[model samples]
Target: MARYARSERESLADLLLALGPDAPTIDEGWVARDLAAHLVIRDRRPDAGAGVILPPLRDYGERIRLAATRRPYPELVDQVRRPPWWSPVSNRLVDELTNTMEFYIHHEDLRRAQPDWQPRQLPAELQAALWRQVGPLARMSLRRVPGRLLVQSPGYGEFSAGSRGEVARLVGAPGELALFLFGRQRVARVQLVGSPALAERLRTARLGF
Candidate 1:
């Protein structure tokens, strides 16, 4: 099987190098170098990666990630491209399962941020893989949201998310839906359908980890 995770990681690394360290990304204040450092730290430094999900470790993780940015930009991109074999998340056995959507989303974080950038025509298999991730992502990110959310990717599938309330629907491709749920609502190409008030709220709600 093709390794989408590996492909996305390589592509992201290439873009980082091509754009140099100063290019902007969809990730708010982060530039290419910062995004590269984040990937390196998340993949290679388990102690700091914990901060991604653990509240108390967040400060420590940010410090480590920020420190990583001072390294040569190419070196940081290389670390992202070729993660250490011993790294927990990127180890051979689990890298596919853990990084497919992670790398894809971050890749787009860089790609979509550039002016005149357009979406890639992804392979159908890759789209299927991304679709599978939507459920868990929505469940996690929308748990606290105040209305019923119906997420639809025509030709793939659809599912309801969020806590119970009036129904609102988000329509987009699998990758776009993933981006929306990951807090890139401003950049994600999704259409909202429902009451104007509820739709606006969902669009602006804090999402992702």
Candidate 2:
């Protein structure tokens, strides 16, 4: 069985090593070093990683992450390249379920910041997997949206989001829709249609996990 998450993790680690520490990523204020440290910390130190989404512990997590960033860049990337088997997020049983989208999105985060970047030709199965993962994300992110929001991926499937009113449609491939939903709207290539104002509002709204 193929594990796309492992492939993506290795590929991203390779790219980060090649790019060096100073390279920019789509993540605001994060360079290659910051991103590498993030991956390492997430896999190696579950306690610290938990704070990434928990406000109360976020400051402490940031401190630990900053410390990790201070280590040699090569060391950080090396850790990312070889996540321990015991890691909650990297263990074989949960790796694919938890990390496919995580690695893909972060891989793109690194790739898209460079010049003349293009989307990869992901396998249909992978696209379908991504589509399934994004539905719940769309629901959560757009739950409070002012108008009805529809996210559609041609030849795949569609998800209706938001709370009420007029409908706004966002159409794209699953990968593109994932990028859009993850707050990469400025760079994601997707068609937005419906009421102009509502569409714009949906486009401009803050999104992501």
Per TM-score, the best of the predicted structures is: 1
Candidate 2 regions with alpha-carbon error over 4 angstroms: none
| Candidate models: Cα lDDT each | 0.92, 0.88
Give the 10-residue window scoring lowest on summed lDDT in candidate 1. Answer: 198-207
Please identify model 1 stretches exceeding 4 Å from their true place.
none
- Worst ten in a row by lDDT for model 2: 140-149
Strongest candidate by lDDT = 1
Supply every candidate's count of residue pairs whose N, Cα or C atoms clash at under 3 angstroms: 0, 0
lDDT of 1 by residue, 99-183 (tens): 9999999999999999999889899999899999989999999988888999999999989988887999999989989999999
In candidate 2, position 191 carries an lDDT of 96
Model 2 lDDT tens row, 1-209? 77889889999999998889999998989999999999999999888998877988898888889999999998899999999999999999999888898998899999999989988999888888888888887887786678887888989988788887898889999988988987888888899999879878878888876
- Cα displacement (Å) at residue 162, model 1: 1.0
